[model samples]
Target chain A: MSTTARRSRLHRQEHLTALAFVALPVIGFLLFTLYPMLFSVYASFTNWNGLTAPVFSGFDNYIAMVQDPYFLESMYNTFFLMLGIPIGLVISLALALAMNRKMRGSTFFRTIYYVPVISSIAAVAILWQWAFNGDFGLINQILALVGIDGPNWLQDTATVKPALIIMAIWKGLGFSMLLYLAALQSVPRHLYEAAALDGAGAWKQFRHITVPMVRPVTFFLVVTSVIGGSQVFVEINIMTPTGGPEFSSATIVWYIWQKAFDNLQMGYASAMSIVLGLMVFLITFIQFRLNRRNQFSID
Target chain B: MSSQRVLPSPPPLKPERNLPDRTSSRAASHTKTRTRPSNSERKHRLGNLIVTIVLSLGAVVMVAPLLWTFSTSLKTREGVFALPPQWIPDPFVWENYLRIWSAGPLLTGIQNSLIVACTVTIVGTLFSALAAFAFAKMRMPFKNVVFLSLLAALMVPFPTLMIPQFTMFASIGWVDTLLPLIVPFIFGNIIMIFFLRQYLNSVPDSIIEAARIDGASFLQIFFRLIFPIIKPAIAAQFILWFMAVWNDYLAPIIYLNSPEVQTLQLVIANFNAQYAIQTDYPLIMAASFVALLPVLIVFIVFQRQIIESIALTGSKG
Candidate 1:
């Protein structure tokens, strides 16, 4: 064969091999991810009960969701749970800033903070449930020492959401802190040196040099935490099996799980899922846009 | 021999050089001015002390729950609820650990969880690494489009597909089996692929070309050349994936209904329900701690690699 023809033949062979490399994952994606995503969207418009054929009842599930008090409560709880996001950002950012300096035992401190992030959600929920127990729990025992009374945390309507939020912030703290630390390390040392030469104090250096440089990492963390926070399930499921008093702790994802499996209302659950998914997508989109605008302003 | 001659030096050593340079540069700048011991230096030392104290307090708070769990596991039922809860059990009971063995299907749960998590991590990492190798090093038509569309999978939340996926798995009679959990993931995990691909991007293409010229096939090149280079990235991803699968509650609860096949998390949930009402705190804590053990071990062993992978995600993004 001519040199050109030989090269073309080699290219064809390489292309075929490349196709083989990706074949399994593409098939898996189509079956497990892509197909189900599309099917669930279709299911949302129906009234299937996971047993019979889904009858097309256009927008009924969506409409019912709007009027459904339980669904709305779950949505409210989900957003309320997201209250941890800002708190987590501030706390983790503070922890990250503190640990960013070349200090003694930073590694040990980082590991301790990260323990909860690595632990099973079931383990965390069970441990926290014990701590939040009304009568003989850790929190109440501490309150007693302070000469104050403590209400049942998971059992009370008002405290259940707060309990969940606190657990979430604790669980998520290490991850966000570590991400921020990474961003902190990557900040050019020269920038800090330059700032110091110009008489910038430590706080001023952190506020000016550190914050702006890590904004993208901060954006990433916010987007992920918001997405994750809204999906809180195992914690509530383990802590309060029945979604707590008056469903105060029923997050959107938790409700979706209950509706689908427990209530056998697959169609209704799919509708809620789509709505929740869209909300997440919209938030992520907005974050991306905001980040892009910030980048432009910086430039 | 020709391949070895054509190949450049390994890339892992570069980071070692970069590290010392970073520290020395900062040190050099710090020593640039040495007039007198300034007030700011004292203030900075004071600041460091404050940070240390604050961080130590936070660390204690972070660890207190786990320590409490372990402590409670060693206590009797009454000891768990004691006012000003005992930091140490007077007579530490080992019965809680022993009881978990005979307690409702805990052993089975551990066995099943180990099977599923181990299989998924080993197989999933292999497949993801293979696909990532192709994406990173090989010339393929529609590569960008294919990879980008696969990334779209990340946007679709788990709940959105839970119902139809359950139906699909049910139709195939995979509902109660571990197939639903293990099979889909063994093909490839997108997140793992994404990370490995990022790590692999730094690897030089010339080495791969040299290997190809020396008559190594695609699979051989991947296993021989690329796999060793990216082993650290794979180790990090393996532990993370193992933690995810081991800690997974929702999927196992949805799929595995039988006591014989349930995972550790499912059993722990059921155990908590059965015992919490009965106030069997020791048994509950023991079970929770047992379920947490493997992940804790993995995290402690591979902490640096895991942190690096996380850091890699932040920096690359």
Candidate 2:
């Protein structure tokens, strides 16, 4: 064979091998995920009780969601959970900064914080349920020490979401901390040194050097936390069986679950699911746009 | 991904070399005459000490709930809810651990969880790997469209499909069986497939060319060459899928109706509510802790591999 022919044959063979590697995942995604997603969009328009065949009912479920008190309550509850994202990001960054120093037992601290990340949400929920139990719980005991009586946390309308938020922070902080720690480590020492040489104080150095360097990481965490926060189901499902007092803690996913499972409102549930997906996607899209703007300024 | 953020090493400061300033002569003279720590050094030392103490205390706070769960499981019923919530369960009720064996339907639930998790992990990894390989290497037309579509799959939000999937499974009369839990594993998971595909794309094209020159088929190249190289990626996906399926509650709740098909999550959720008459709080907590053992074991065993893979993958993600 000519040299050119030999090289071309080898190149073709490599391309063929590449082709083989990507085949199965493509087919699977088409069959499972994409198909189901498309299926969901179509299903949202139909009146189906999961058992019966889906019937065409144009815009009814969507129209119903506009007026549905339960859906509105769930939306409110979802935004309530989202409040934790900013608080969580700041607290996690603070924790990460504290740990980033060459302190003794740093690994021990990282591992300690990360324990909750791996823990089952069900386990965390049950544990929190006990801790937030109205009468004999630990939070109440602590409250009593401070000369304040605590309400039935999970059952009280005012306290339920806050209690869940506290648990969410406790459950969530470790993962965010790990992400921040990674971001913090990536920051160059020269930047800090340059700031120090310029007579910048520690706070100023952190504000100018550390924060800008880790902006991408911060953006990533905030976006993801919002996504995860909106789908807050297992925590509520386990901790507050009735979805908290007066349905205050029933977030979007949890509400959809109740509709589909308890009320057998499959059509309505599917519509709610679409709305939730759009909300998450929109938030993420906004975040990415905002991230690009931040990156542009930083660069 | 965090590991990639290596800071540039600053030049080491020598006391004499960098002390060319007017302030240094006075500072040097003051320090040279004294063995006692200066106020600034004392403050620095104090600051360091404070940070160390605070960080460690934060660690304790972070881990306290886990410790609480563990220690409380060892306590007697009275001790479990004691007013001052005993940090130390003196004369620990060893029966709490022992009674878990006698706990109702726990053994069955454990078996069910293990079967589902194992099946999900093994099958999910295989399917995902196969799909990932196809996406990474196969030369089909319209590949990017398919790949982008697959990426889009990650955003569908899982709950959106739960009702429909349940309905679909119910139509096939698979809802009550382990089929709903296991069948999807055969189809493949989007997240795992994406992870594998990304890692496989990083594998150099030259190795596959070498295999193909010897007249190896696509399947052979995949099984022998591609698979071996991506073991780290596979192990990473394995741990993730294992944890996910093991901890999954929503699916099992929706699909598995019978006691025979119940997952560990469902069992734990219903442990106090269902088996309340038979076992008390300590026993329930003990069983709960026992249920957590497999996850802990998996975490400890693959913790290093998982963490490194996450660090690597998180950068690209």
TM-score of 1: 0.96
Q: Write the per-residue lDDT of candidate 2 for residues B201-237, one digit (tens) a residue.
A: 6666666566655667777777767676677668877
Off by over 4 Å in 2: A1-21, B1-45, B275-279
**Residue A35 of model 1: what lDDT?**
94
Which candidate number has the best DockQ? 1
Measured over all alpha carbons after superposition, the RMSD of each candidate to the real structure, in angstroms, is 2.0, 7.3
For residues A1-299, write the lDDT of model 2, one tens digit per residue. 69999878766775665555555656656656667767888889988777677899999999999999988999999998888888888888898888775545666676677767777888778777777878767678768889889999988888898888888888778777876776676676678879899999999998998889778777777877888888888888877778777889888999999989998888889889988888888998898899889889987
TM-scores for all predictions? 0.96, 0.88
DockQ of each: 0.69, 0.45
- For residues A1-299, write the lDDT of model 1, one tens digit per residue: 69989999998899899888887788889988999989999999999999999999999999999999999999999898888899999999999989976657888998999999999999899999988889877778778889889999989998999888888898989999988988887788789889999999989998888889999889889888888877889998899889889999988999999999999999999999999889889988999999999989878
Clashes of each: 0, 18
